[model samples]
Target: MDAPISWAEARTAMHEAGRQGARPAVAVPLSETDGTTLAAPLTSRTDVPAFPASAVDGWAVRGPQPWIPEGRVLAGERPPALTRPGTCMEIATGAMVPEGTEAIVRLECAHHEHGRITGVARARRDWREAGEEVSAGEELLPAGSPVTPAVIGLAASSGHDTLHVHRPPSAAVLVFGDELKTAGLPGLGRIRDSLGPSVPSWLRRLGALPVEGPAHPVADTLEDHLAALTSALKTADIVCTTGGTMHGPADHLHPALRELGAEYLVDTVAVRPGSPMLAARLPGGKFVCGLPGNPQAALTALMTLTEPLIAGLTRRPLPSLRTVPVAEETIGRGDFTHLAAARLDTHGRAHTLGHAASSMLRGVAAGDGFVVVSPGGVVDAGMHVPFLPLPLYAGEAPVAVRQEGVPAVPLPDQAHAHSTAPR
Candidate 1:
C-alpha cells in the first residue's frame, strides 16, 4: 500500500485534478450569479462617475470668490458652462460640474449678500474627477473570483448586465454501510445514518450543488457499491461515499475504484482522525471521495480533500488558512498532524473543545473550526497556529470577524455563538 501523504499534499492534488477538469463557463444575469465564479475579468465599460461631479451640495464656482449665483443644477441635470467670470451655479451632490468650474463652495459655508455668493474654497477639491473610482476598461476583478453580493453591485456599476461565470459543480452522496439505519432512532446495534443527511449540506456550503433528494444507503456488498457509484457518477461531477475507506473486510471502496478504472489522487492523509480518507479521479474526470465512517473524521476528510477540489472546480482560489493564538497547550499526534476542534473567543484566541473523539460531532458542532498542529509539535498557550474555518452556508457570516488592520476574532456578542444557519 502507498504511504499516507501530507494533508497539504492531498489538498493540492485534488485541487489540481478539479482544475484540469473545470466546467465550462456561461453568461448569467447579475440576479442569478450570486454563488457563481467569474469566468472573465470584470472590466469597467465606462469611467466610474463618468464625468466630473459635485461631491457636496454647494456652488460650482468658476474663477474667484464673491461670484454671482446662477441657476441651480440638481443631480443628473446638465448645466451650462460657467463662461462668465466670477459666476457660480448651485449644484447638488453628485451633480455634474460645468466646464470652467474652479471649485465647490459648500452651501453652509457660502455667504450670501446682495444676491451674490462669497465663500473660501477648502484646500481639497470638492468635486470628483472623471474616472476617480475606476478608469474605463480597467479590470475590477480577475477571472476565478467568487461572485459575491459586492461583486454583483460592482458589476452593475461597471455597466455589466450579465456576467460570464463558471457553473457550480454538482455532487451526490452515497452511504455505504449496512449497519447504518436511514430512518428512526438507532437500535439493535444499528446506527442512524448521519452522513447521508448532512454531507449534502456541507457540499452546498462548499459551493457544490448537491443532487436532489436524500441519499439511500448502499449495502456493504461489492456489487451494491459498484452499482451505486456508477449511478451517481452518471449525474454528479463528484460522488462522496461514506464508510468502507479502510481496507477492512467490509471495505469495498478500493475494490470498486479499481474496477471502475479510477486513478488515486490521494490515497490517504497523515492526519489524525481521518487518515483513512481517500480521493480518486474516475474515468472521464468525475471524482470519488471516500470518507471514514466516524462523523468528525468524515468532516475532517471533507475539509482536507473535497473543499479544495470544489474550489478548483468552481474556479475559486484555494481557501487560505489564517493564524490564531491558542488559549491553551495543544498536544500533537506524534508523527501525524492533528486537527483539533477549537472555538474562537472575543479576543481571537483558540480554545480547543472537549468531546473531540473521532466518532463524536459535538466538539465540532460547537466550535468555529479546527486548529492544525504540526507533527510532533506541541503548541503552547499564546502561540499562533494555522486555522481552517468550517464551511459556511451562502450569505452566512464567518464565525470569525475579519476586518482590515483588526484582529481576526469573534465579536463580543458572537463569542460563543455557532455560525447562523438558514431556517
Candidate 2:
C-alpha cells in the first residue's frame, strides 16, 4: 500500500494547481468587491480627507477663548479660510475646517455668550490636517489583501470608485453514489445527499462564486463517472466530488481521471477520517477534489484541499493554520493528524465536541472549529494545537487588527441557513 501524502504536501499541491488556473483580475464596482482579494496594490487616487476637516462636532477656533463667531460649517460644505486670529467657525463632524484653523472646541467645552466663543483647551490643531489619513499616490492596501468591508470603506475614502480584484472562482459539485437521495428521510439502503448544500457554503466562505447548479449525481458505473467528470470540468474552475475516493470496486474517480489524462496532485492525505481524500489537475487546468462519502471526512478533505485552492484562485495568501491552547485532552489516529470537532470557551481554551465521528455532522453543528491533535501524540491540556474555524464561523479579529481581518457574516443563502438531507 502506498503511504498517503502529508497534509501539508497535499495542500501545497492544490494551492499550486489553483494558482496556475487563477482567473485573471477584473475591475468590479466597489459594492461587489467584498469577499474578493485585491489583484493589485491599492493606491489612493487623492488625499483621504481632501482638506482639513473637523474631527468632532464643535467650533474651529484660532488663538483660543472668546473668539468672534464667523459662521457655521456643516458637513459637506466648505468654509472660507480664516482671515485672522481670534476668529471661530461652528463645525460639525466631517465638515471641512477653514484654512489657518488652530483647534476644535467640543460643544460642551465652549461657552458662548453675545456671539463670542470661550474655551479652555490645551491641545492645538484638534482637526484633521489635509493628507493626514492618507496622501495622494500613497499605497492604502497591499496586493493579495482580502477585500473586506473595512477595506471597501478605505478605498472609497481614498477616492476609488471600483477595485481591481480577482474574478470569483466558479465550482461544480458531483456527488457519486447510487444510493443517495436528495430529499426526505432515507430508508431501504439509501441515504439523503448532504454535499449539495454544505459544500457550496464552504466554497463561498473561501471566495468562490455560487455553484453553477445542483450537483450532478453519479452512479457506481465508470461510464456515469466519466461523463459527469467531463461535463463538470468544462465550466467549473474546480469540481468537488463527494464519495468514490477509495479503491472500492465502485470507486471510479481514479479511472475517470486516467481516461481524461488528468494528473493526480494528491492521491491521499495523512489526516484521520479523510485519508482517502484526493485532488487532481484536469487536462485543461481545472481541479477536481475527491472527498470521502462520510460527512466529516468530506469536510476534512475540504479544509485540507479546497480552502487553499480557493485562496490561491482568489490571489490571496494561504496563511498558516491558526492554533489555540486546548483545555481538555483529546485523542485520535496516532499515525495521522487527528481532527476533532471542538469549541472555544470564553476562557480561550479548546474543548472537544463529542459525537465527532466521520459519519456524523452533529458535532460539527455544535462546534465552532476543528481541533488538531498531532500524529501519535496525546494532546495534553494547555497544549498549543492547530484549529480551523468552520465555514463562515471565524469572527472578527481583535480591535487592534480589525481593519485587517474584519468579521464576515454568512449570507442568508449560505449553508447555515439551508439544510441538506444526510448522506
Candidate 3:
C-alpha cells in the first residue's frame, strides 16, 4: 500500500475538493437560530431605532439651558417639534425626539422647578439618531457569518424576526467494536463505549445538530456494518465510523465503503495516534470519516478531518490555526506530525499534558488545546507551535454520572462556548 499522506496535505486536499456548502438557505426564526451560519447577506430592512430616540432620561431642549418645558414624552411616545432654541421637552429614555430639538438636558443636570427646566450643561444630542445602529438597506453581516447571540440581537434590531441562515448539518456516528460495552467502567477485557457518548457532543460544537439517541454501536460483522452505513446515509449528511480503519478481521470500514460506492479522499495521515483514520466521499454528495477506536485517536481524527468537513458542509469558514509558545521543551516524531494534549496558562502559553495516550481522554478533557508538532520538529521552551483548540466553556471539569448505563464524563458547556479557537 502507498504511504499515508502528511496531515497538512490531507487537510488541504479535503478542503480543496470537498463539496462546497451549496445547501439551500432556510429562513429560520431568530429565536431558534443561534449558532447557524448566515447563507444570505443580513441587510437592514428598516433603520435600527427607526427614528431618533432618547439615549438617556433627560430633557429635549432646542439649544441650551433655562428653556420652557413643553411636556413629558416617555418611551414609545413621539414628541412634537421644539420649534425654538429657548424651548425644551421632558424626554424619557427611548422616547422619540421632536424634529427641531438641538440637544438633551439630562435629568441630573436639569434643575426642574415649577415645571421649568434649567442648567443644561451643553448643547449635544443624547438620543440615538435614526439609523444609528444600521441604516435601511445596509448589510449588517455578510453571508457565511456565524449566527451568535449578538448577531441575533443585531438582526432583531434591524427588523428581522427571522434570518436567512445556512441550516445545521446532521451527522451519524457508527461505533464499531466487539469489546465495547454500552455502559459502566471498563474491566474484564470489555471497555465502556466512550465514543458513543462523546462523538455526538463534539459534532454539535462544530455546528451540526445534536445526536438524539446514543451513537450506533455496530457488531463486528460486515453485513451489520453495511446495514448501519446504508441507514445512516439515508438521513445524515455525514457518517462517522469508529474503530474499523485497520485491516483486522473485525474491521469493516474499508470494505463496506468500497461496496457502498465510497471513493477515498483521505486513506490516512502521517500523524501520531491517528494514522489509521480514513475519509471518503459517498454517493449523493455525502461523506464518511473513519476514526480509530482509541479515545484520543478518535479526537485527533475529529479535529483533523471532521472539523473542516463540518465547516465545509455547513458553509462556515474553516478555523484558522494559531501558533503559541510552549512552557517546556518536548520531543517530537521525526517523520510525522504529533498532536499532544496541553493546558494553556494565564498568559496564553501552553503546558504539555502527560496523559495523552491513544486510549485515554484524561488529558484531553482536562486541557485547553493540542500542540501540533511538525515533522522533525524539536519543540523548545518559548518556541511557537500550531495549536488546535476545543470549545472551552468553564474550562472542562468532571461531572457526576449516576446512571448505570451512562458514562461519567466532563463535557464543555456548548451554549457558552460560542467562540472558536482561543487566542
Best-fitting candidate, measured by TM-score? 3
Q: Give per-residue CA lDDT, model 3, range 1-423, as digits (tens).
A: 358988877765666544363477888999988878888889999988899998898888877556888787988876788888778888888999888987887889878777677875555558889988888999877787778788889888888899888777788888998899987788999989989888888887766775453344799999998999998888888888889899988888888999999888898888886989998988778888899999999989988888777767667655556566789986676677888899989887899998889998999988977887766666778776666787553212111111234332111111111123232
Q: Compose the digit string of candidate 1's lDDT tens values, residues 1-423.
A: 599987777777888888888978999999999878899999999998899988899998987768998889999898899998899999999999998898899999999999999998899999999999999999998897778899999989878999999988889998888899988999999999888889999988878889963356888899999889998999999999889999999999999999999999999888887999999998799999999999999999998899889888977766666667889999888767789999999988899999999999989999989988777767778777777788666633233323235344332122211122111
Q: Please give the lDDT score for candidate 2.
A: 0.78
Task: For model 3, name the residue pairs that clash.
Answer: none
Model 2 TM-score (2 dp):
0.86
Decoy 1 TM-score against native: 0.83
Best by lDDT: 1
Model 1: residue 140 alpha-carbon error in angstroms: 3.0
Worst 10 residues of 1 by lDDT: 414-423
Instruction: Please say which candidate is ahead in TM-score: 1 or 2.
Output: 2
**lDDT score for residue 269 of model 1:** 89
A best-first ranking of the candidates according to their TM-score comes to: 3, 2, 1
Of the two candidates 1 and 2, the one with more favorable lDDT, higher being better, is 1
Off by more than 4 A, model 1: 63-69, 105-124, 181-184, 213-215, 393-423
- Stronger candidate by lDDT (1 vs 3): 1
